[model samples]
Target chain A: MAAFIIANGAAAMGDDVTMFFTFWGLNALRKPENIKVKKSFLQGMFGKMMPRGADKLGISKMNFGGMGAAMMKTVMKQQNVTTLPELIQTAKEQDIKMIACTMSMDVMGIREEELIDGLEFAGVATYLGEADEANVNLFI
Target chain B: MAAFIIANGAAAMGDDVTMFFTFWGLNALRKPENIKVKKSFLQGMFGKMMPRGADKLGISKMNFGGMGAAMMKTVMKQQNVTTLPELIQTAKEQDIKMIACTMSMDVMGIREEELIDGLEFAGVATYLGEADEANVNLFI
Candidate 1:
């Protein structure tokens, strides 16, 4: 959530923002609806265990069986802070580059069609190249 | 562990490295010996619950009640990979700059006297200033 907020904030300020999702972070990019993609046994189990999308994500701290996430969302709504989905939408609207690490996707058996639209799938080398040119490259 | 390894690697290559420790990352910078400091009840509890130093830290993944961390350390030893403590020592030896986030320390109730020596304390503004001048700034 911090990553998205920062990315959106940077984009809002006319800064070119790029978000690279890898490993568990890729779960945030999964479509809310289940996508029928063939996978190995372990990957299938992994997929079933992991949350599908941003809304399904749990807060890192004090997530008492997801109650904390619900409370956080409620508080955020009350505070008029942009919700995670809204932040994601804003990111798309602002043309923030969202890249999913291809190596992680392959390792986790996540197919391209399983993720949302407007994402570029690439490897770490691409991220490194981008980082080289970027003034601030953050790994959240 | 990744942070320390990367810092050590970068410093070894003669690139000036600065590691800004925040939140749980501060635990790695703590002195192993118990330090008696006056604190609120909550602060004392927080300090007691958290790991004191790098050696007491657990692996993020597959750490089944610290067994996984022990297994990983053994494997790292077998593979000749630098241990976390060794990586931290190498970072110090190579003159890598390490800063502990003061805001995080206050929030987590960690004291300067409880932390290892050779660390600078600063806030986010200092991080931003350093990052602005950095060619590649990574959050991790």
Candidate 2:
């Protein structure tokens, strides 16, 4: 199976990270200025989940005042861990691969024209080829 | 890179659910009866300062505190998720492959004999095969 951590936490941990920009995942890869926001509890209770772009669902590191994202950054910083922005730059510099799903882009009305530069267009087969070979895979 | 969610969380969320176990992940794979008591406060504090496994340094889910473990189980039930024990059994039934790092086990004083049955012993090469092949990999 393909392990997907749709979230961007890995970048902050300073690991080589790649995100298959499918569905919500595209939010982060989209124009950086375009911040994705998640739906509210009322949505889930009414089956009206927001399912917004993924960057919206990031885990708050410290979760202070629901500032988990900021808290995470602080804890990691106190420990000398890297930040998400830094991770993105590092992965690109190190040649860590990033794949954006063509099908997803179409389904969500996204266009390659909308994505940030330096992304590759791929499909299920590409994801599977990478996932099947991994000894450890995760869907976060 | 590996994704490590404490198998002990089985009590908080049932184990039958699919959880990608890596790093201290193999800790839960140890036998339930042999599980050690929860790591100490000092250990937790140190872990807070160290990398993920600092708390799990000497413990696995199986031999960890029975009372504490049971409490985790109760919380998961209240939360409506699966239990850890059930997760392990489910992993077997689902054929979710789990690999225990030989190096960490060695450093932590664990032996193949101490782990829960059915674990695959592997090293960097094994992980490399998976990492190179997988589209998404993580270290949590």
Candidate 3:
């Protein structure tokens, strides 16, 4: 949620924004109904235990069995702020670059078709190359 | 560790940086030997179970009984990268603004003395004020 907010804000300000999603971060890009994955026993457990997508994700701290997430959503709504999904859509509309890490996808058994469309795929080198020239690079 | 790495890297590159420590994030600023807190039972449990300071912090993912943190430290050493504590100290030396959220400290019953020196205290308003003027604002 924070990533999408920042990305949208930066993109709105005309900054060239790139969100490199890797590991669990890729969960945000997963289609809500198509989040199934095949992996080792423990890895599969991890996948099953995790929230399906951005809408279901709990906040990192003070998340009282998902209550905190719900409260946050309510607060955002009350404040007339865009929802996480809306922020993501806004980011897409603003043409912010979204890169999915190929290595992580392979290890996690996530296929391209399972993710939302209009995203590029690359490895660490690609991210480093972009970070090298960028003035502001963040990992949220 | 990720936060410190990014902070130190940005500061080294002559970027003005501000890290707002809130809730669990304040744990990283706690002085390892003096981390005692007087909160509600559950909050105290949360405080006690968490790592004491930057050195004791575990990674967000793949933290297998602290092994992942140890391995990460080892890798940093092998790569001639600064440890988390060292990176934090570097951030301090580079004059990166470190703000401990007053609201979080109050809720957690964390005394200001328990945190490292040479830091400031503020609320969200101050952070927003800084972020409003800055070209690069990130939450980690």
Please, what are the lDDT tens digits per residue for candidate 3 over residues B1-140?
77788878888898888998876788889888955555555445455656678888788888898899889889989999888788888888899999998756655557788888988999656665576667676667
The better-scoring model by TM-score among 2 and 3 is 3
Q: What is the interface RMSD of each candidate, in Å?
A: 5.6, 9.4, 6.9
- Among incorrect, acceptable, medium and high, the docking class of model 2 is incorrect
lDDT of 1 by residue, A1-140 (tens): 76886677567656788889999999999999999999999989889999999899997754668765675566456446677788899999999999999999988989999999999989999999998888777878
Model 1 error, position B44 (Å): 2.8
Q: Chain A only: list TM-scores of all candidates.
A: 0.98, 0.60, 0.90
Docking class of 3: incorrect
lDDT of each: 0.83, 0.51, 0.77
Cα lDDT tens digits for candidate 2, A23-53? 7666556654433334354422322232233
lDDT of 2 by residue, B1-140 (tens): 11223433342454332233443455556654443444444333322432232123332245354565556656768997765556566556555567777644443335566567776887544565555455445455
Query: Candidate 1 vs candidate 3: which has greater lDDT?
Result: 1
The complex in candidate 3 yields a DockQ of: 0.12
